[model samples]
Target: MAIDFVRSLRGHPVRPPASGIARRTSFWQRMHVDPWLLGMLLVLMCSGLAVLYSASGENVHVVTAQAIRFGVAWAVMLVLAQFSPATLMRWALPAYLAGLVMLVAVEILGDVGMGAQRWLVIPGVVRFQPSEMMKIAMPMMVAAWLSRHELPPNWRALAGCALLIALPVGLIARQPDLGTSLLVAAAAVFVILLAGLSWRFIGVMVALAGAALPLLWMNMHNYQRQRVLTFLDPESDPLGAGWNIIQSTTAIGSGGVWGKGWLEGTQSQLEFLPERHTDFIVAVLGEEFGLVGMLAFLLLYLLIVARGLWLAGAAQDTFGRLLGGGIMLTFFIYVFVNIGMVSGILPVVGVPLPLVSYGGTSSVTLMAGFGILMAVNAHRRLLPR
Candidate 1:
């Protein structure tokens, strides 16, 4: 309901504060902390850690590693939250430029471990994905640029935004990471969407996308094409290209309404589901907690999205609205695409479940975004900077 209402007001100017009007800052706001969102994140982290334990087959080593990452990311989130939106906007371009450079560096000096050159290892320092940086930077860059202009940007502005988005998307896709590229693209696009891009134009773009499918298919790598084919008919390959989907769906279906019990799912515990700790972990969730467990996680995700949208709707300036909304929607896509792929409804693209999946850079990027959201909410009364 709030999302729809926000959509209806898309092109309208954000209600300007009454002359000299400002709400009294609460202790939480002054501290740049959103107690509500922080509480939600804490609950999510704990729940996800529990799920990760079961998903990793109760591997304390893996669980401990993920917890450490969560702690590091949590610190990063809180620290970023302390910066005002003006400070964040000031650093936006530099961050985006740095992200692009790192992406290029990834192509040049990045490591190769999982058949794709998407990681940059600082040799005993840290191994991370440069593309992850773009997840936050893309929105910041777009919002920074467009917030200077009027709403429902014209063709020239749209073209400029496209260039900004395409450069990184091209680089990341060249890294052969379809999932990350889609996410990076989504972040930039959400900014445009919220800035009031017209439905007619969106329809035209959708049609163009449809028309280009053949070309897109031709350009896809063999594995990428195979994933689409498997999505269409998993039974054809059942044990080969389709094993993941088949097993994952079975794991979910076998759980029925109440599930087999935590750490007790046959597909996960017996190693039948591929990537049980990462991409397909939602299946582990479904199989263990059943429909009820799956719905609980979904509810958590919905709460996050709703809270994020509320922040976006209440943002004092265009930059805050676009950046906060973009971040939230991108987070939404992370949850949707991961769960959709795991359930066999969408082609697998290797998107991990938001806070639930075990990964360092992903969690950091995600938390950093919420931190930005907090910054926007906390500093709403002050002028942008």
Candidate 2:
């Protein structure tokens, strides 16, 4: 067979048949994978594992467990990517509804942890946060709704969107998880903005938000209010409300141009830095990897965001475009909030550092959003022959 093929190719440059070429091209689309996006995610994931090992005090068990979670999350992302855009759109409402029910369940049946009722448990079966589900569902819900309606939504559409956003957000606030509530609301708002919300309407909403601040302040929990105040003047209660920010800033600042070297930061290694492995993992990365490593990691994240937005634009349908944009922008918000929180520029609301932060549900949710982006990209209309 080899000799015959070699003889057949004599006197002409061999070329793959057009069908074979298409088969090669369509393999990626068939599998619903985006190579560039996947490559970036892998870099972040691997970098996260290295940083996590140091942050967790070089504990094998901690690293192993995180590795397991990444495994599961990676599988979930690929599974989500296998669906087409229409199927995803069809799923949007039901998933949103299911997420709402889960939020309500968290209110009644959830376990209390730290200071919030955020986790739902089934004894040895499984335990997870319900609000994380909203991270994906919110954008899906709003995008599906907006895709069916006009651009720059009308009053009725806006009201419908608000109602959709408020249900889960209200339930989450009752859980008193301000961090999650803000993220969920942010996801929904991004979708609405992508629906081509008008500038005049945007200004009006901004003014309304400004007016609502007082009411919001009045409604905040005492601890929540303290967070805001502490953000303004952290040293006022150095040992109490201020410890986290103080310690975090110290860790980042002490890093200098080049870090103290991996696992060498006194704040984290000495247990002075709060939530070192989770919400403030950035401080760990900053301390060990220094300015160069932090800059490289940030550039990688920005590339992922840029690519995600480009995929959204490449999507032929309105639903894919809006949903994809919503997911990507919300992802950027997560990175911003977590880094800002740890750096003391924003109040610590317990937001984690995207894939780098240690957590099962959060990591999975972030990956699943990328999966949706993959699906949108893969299922796009093929070009004419």
Candidate 3:
């Protein structure tokens, strides 16, 4: 069959077959198959396995649970990426609205954990974070909405986008999960920025937001205020509110260049580091894998973000571009804030390191965001009939 086709092509100097009386379908399909991004994710997952093995050394159950989480998360990403952007667009608003309802529900009847109301329980299953859904859904909703109109040259669409971002942000904050709230808001902001909102308007918004910080500070929970103050002067409460930061910094500093080696991290092994598997997983990486490992982790993040941006830039439509760009930048926010909080450069706010931290909701959420990006990339130039 192959020889026959080649022979057929020989006539008239191999008159080439022309494209699309039927609109070539391959371009749309091509974006959905992202081996590079998927490979990076696999590497991240493997690194997570190594880090978790050390961090969860004494807690065998922790390793088991996390393995299960990673498996499920990868599966979710695979399943999600198989869908087209049209399918995702159809779900965006409904998904966002559902997430919003859940967020509101969380406020009314949430299960409190470690001084935060961030989880919802379903009988016989695990309690998961509703805000994670908001993170993904908010961006999709905003992107879908803005794609309907031209870039927000007017205030109304911009305000609508802001309102969409803010409602979930306010709800997450009310749950006292400032980290997730900030992330969710940032995801929507990424979409808004990709929507081409004016820089002058953005600056004015920033100025107004900064002006309101004092009032915001006044309304913050006592512990929340202490975290900000502690970030500025960690020494002020050495044995008190600042213990986590102080210990995290000590672990990172002591790691030196090559680190203490895997499973040999004194701070993590000796249990001096709190939340070593969750919010502060970086301490384990710093203590064991050291600076080299940290850089590797960062490089993975950089690659993922760069690829996402490239896809967004190549997208042929506003929705695909905004959606891809938004998800890409949000991933950056996750990397930045998680590492910043763990390194004690920013307040500890329970932000999980993407693909590295051990949380079912978070892992799935991050993967789903990537999956959406893959979908957008796949369908950037084509429309689904």
Candidate 4:
């Protein structure tokens, strides 16, 4: 099956060389399962399991749970990929509204974990981070809203879009999950940018954002501020706020050129690196596989991003293009922020490393985004005039 899929991707007709050969590409092709994209995702998931096993102190249970989560996420991706772009767009506004209601519910009656009220649990049923839904909903909402109007939206339209972006972002930030708020905000902004908002307005917004930094800093929680301070001078409080970064950098540096070998990272093995199974998993990868491994992982990520952008560009309608582009950019932000914080280049904001990190919410949310990307690609031909 894999061989035939690869051949089909390469533009060869899927045929048996002998007589009585049956072709099998139609279903997958109809479902819009881009072999390259699916292959990359599988590779990342496999590598994630390997790193996660080592990070979890060789815990079989942890790896099993992660594998199960990936299975669910993959199923979701396949199902979502089967939808046409128009079908997705039709659901956009409702999804956004439902997400907003969930966010509001969180504000009123959410569960607190790790000092943040970010999850809403239904009695004996399900619990999830509403903010994760925003990661997809914001872009879809913005894209749909913008698509209804003109290209290069005027200042009035931009203001409406800003309001659309701001509502959930503000709600998430109030939950004090700054990392997610920023990610959701960035996704919506990407949709606006792709919609061709005028450069003049963009410049003014940028300048305003620069000026607002001080005010934004003032509003941040003390711990958030401490993260920034710790990022600047981790040595200032080596035993306190700086411990995670110090250990992460140490793990990365000790890996040298070729790494210490799989499951042999002293930092993670010795339990010196915090969150080794989650946000700081990259450090585990760096320690176990070194620069070579990190680069290889990044190359896979690059291919996914490139393909996402290509799908966005190829999309026949404004909504598909904006939504696809937004998802791609948001995914990039997740990778950049995770790698940056792990490397001590960016302040810690608790953003997980997409698929490679051991987390259920982010994994599902990210894969769903990819599913939408696939939908955009697959359903482009069916887009309405």
Candidates' lDDT values, in order? 0.91, 0.90, 0.83, 0.91
> Which predicted model would earn the best TM-score?
2
Candidate 1 TM-score versus the reference = 0.92
When 2 and 4 are scored with TM-score, the better candidate is 2
Candidate 4 residue runs with Cα over 4 Å from true position = 1-25, 381-385
Report the lDDT tens digits of candidate 3 across residue range 267-361: 99999988888888898999887898798889988998898789778877777788889988988988898899878888877788888777788
lDDT accuracy of residue 210 in candidate 4: 100
Task: Count clashes in each candidate, considering only residues at least 3 apart in sequence or on different chains.
Answer: 1, 0, 1, 0
All-Cα superposition RMSD per candidate: 6.8, 6.7, 5.7, 6.5
Poorest 10 consecutive residues of model 4 by lDDT? 17-26
Please provide TM-scores, in order, for all candidate models, with all chains considered together.
Answer: 0.92, 0.93, 0.90, 0.92
Candidates sorted by TM-score, best first: 2, 1, 4, 3
Clashing pairs in 2: none
Off by over 4 Å in 3: 1-31, 381-385
**Which candidate, 1 or 2, would have the higher lDDT against the true structure?**
1
Model 1 gets an lDDT of 0.91
Candidate 1 — worst ten consecutive residues by lDDT sum? 1-10
lDDT of 2: 0.90
**On residues 1-385, what C-alpha lDDT tens digit does candidate 4 reach at each position?**
5676678789998766566765444666777877788888899899889999999999999999999999999999999999988899999999999999999999999999989999999889777898999999999988998898888887688888889988999999999999999999999999988888677878989999999999999999999999999999999999999999999999998998899999999999999999999999999999989999999999999998998899789988788999999999989989999999999999999999989898888889999999999988888744322
